[model samples]
Target: MIVSGVILLALVAVGGYGLLSGTDSEMAPVHRDPAPSSTASPRPETPSRPQVPRILPTSNPETFARRVAAALFTWDTGAGLMPLDYTSAILDVGDPSGTEQAGLAADIATYLPSREAWVQLRQYATTQYLTIDNIAVPDAWSEAVAQAQPGQLPPGAIAYTIDGVRHRDGIWNDVPQVLTAPVAFTVFLACPPDGDPCYLLRLSQLGSPLR
Candidate 1:
């Protein structure tokens, strides 16, 4: 009987050991979620600004005029003072703000930093060195008569604005007007064979009239 009891106790101890081992094995395993990885791509940043059209603004008239004058000087005078597609004429009366096409620079309220006439000589043989192509010597300019008839505006007639015009000599001719400052006008090729749009530019100096 003692031997049988000892054998039963040994069997019970073996069973308890088995149970503890199973429990330890289950608890030993570590649990964790997979490491996170970024899936989104980096986005580029843009400037936050109020976009406006970059153009010749009418709000600032002075700035606009100055810009135009500078451009004309470079276009016309920069070509070695060569007689270009247009001719330079005198208006006689000094008017800086005048929009007349044919005019004098001195008579105008302002002149460029320096304007000097350069006489060029052309030679084909031993003698005739001067030619009209080299430099233009003025002969005479005929007075341009008005093609349009002169008349006052009818009663209640709508009128178009003449920005710098002091007086209308006639329907087609304008009289000389004085400007408070100096300005510039550019002569352009009026019409072309290719049928491109053409226009003349008028530029007003920033400051003039010594005031």
Candidate 2:
């Protein structure tokens, strides 16, 4: 498991933050009035569900890291999508060897809204995306790399810590509401020196990325 392997690196904390903070508080209860279909004008059609954006193949570590970060944050509740729908997008770009897939799935579950929360948030037509402030390889990661024994790490493995703000928007009682919060996390991946594309390995706990 990737969690066990990452423990050897001593790279990150054990678990992620609690559920996306303030999601429920920011959302208002569903309104209970009914507009008669005959008296009410036709409601605008909901937009078609978007295609899940998968992480693109890339040999550049920073480029791949940024894509992973964005995939982790960008989501919509009103698009006829669920949290698992978003999860699948990231898993599509996960470690192809399947070694870390289970750990990766658990890590991802922490960063997204829960299924029950998803159903509630849908009432508000909520959406979210990240605005990255910075991305870099942390000093601790370099030290860990130097300390690693031969065969301890994968060929071309690297880590990038991302700092950003998570911005969420939703309609509440006929008014649009927006919330912004700072976020940080690390992405572990490998781009083999032999010209293969990068593949996601694991994610550090949310709010506890390596320095």
Candidate 3:
């Protein structure tokens, strides 16, 4: 199915730190460096390990979608959560298998920054809001499923649109600033033949707003 021109509104909190402001078309993911700090202190002797977010697995697609969206958009530099840790947390929630897991790892490697960068910047997402507009199967996925073995095919596939706002405190002034954008992605779900359970099969970005 062609999922276009569909829209929805959802207001989600970012672990009680920030608020989502508007509804509109998809935007590119935003990455901004924190302004230079006026008061600089010696770097910590020992960097703390990142605290990964809790993963609450669920069979419901919509709920899982929301979780994935939030995980992809949120981060905490102050708490020592690095980009790799963030990626690991997201993977834990999805529980992908085999090649899917490998693909996710590769994607994370390509997109996430190095540990040194995280340590130097100390900038992380304070808040994020994801507005899931539509869920539908893409034609290419449908055809692929049709040609595949019954059990090999994903139970469901959906393309969803989400808008988000990432917040961070300005480095020099200590003022808060927000980076707003929208994103779209296609997700594939793996469901058991029996009455077992469901998990994320694969996720791929469809489009994003221009920076």
What lDDT does the true structure give each of the candidates? 0.21, 0.78, 0.46
Candidate 2, residue 151: how far the Cα is off, in Å: 2.1
Error of 2 at 17 (Å): 5.9
Q: Candidate 1 local accuracy as lDDT? A: 0.21
lDDT, candidate 3, 1-211, per-residue tens? 1111120101111111122222112122444445457576434344335467754666565566667666665555555456678888767745344535655555444334456555544543233335555544444544454555544444453333334433333232344555554455544455444534456544453342111
| Model 1's TM-score against the true structure | 0.19
The best-first sequence of candidates by TM-score reads: 2, 3, 1
Tens digit of per-residue lDDT, candidate 2, span 1-211: 4444443344343554333322322322343345557688644454445688778888999999999999999988766667899899999988888988887888898888889888777777778999999999988888767766666668898999999999888777767888888998889888999989998888888887877
Model 2 segments more than 4 A misplaced = 5-50
Per-residue lDDT of 206 in model 1? 19
TM-score of each: 0.19, 0.80, 0.58
Badly placed stretches (over 4 Å) of model 1 are: 1-59, 75-99, 103-208
Minimal lDDT window, size 10, model 1: 16-25
**Residue pairs with clashing backbones, model 2:** none
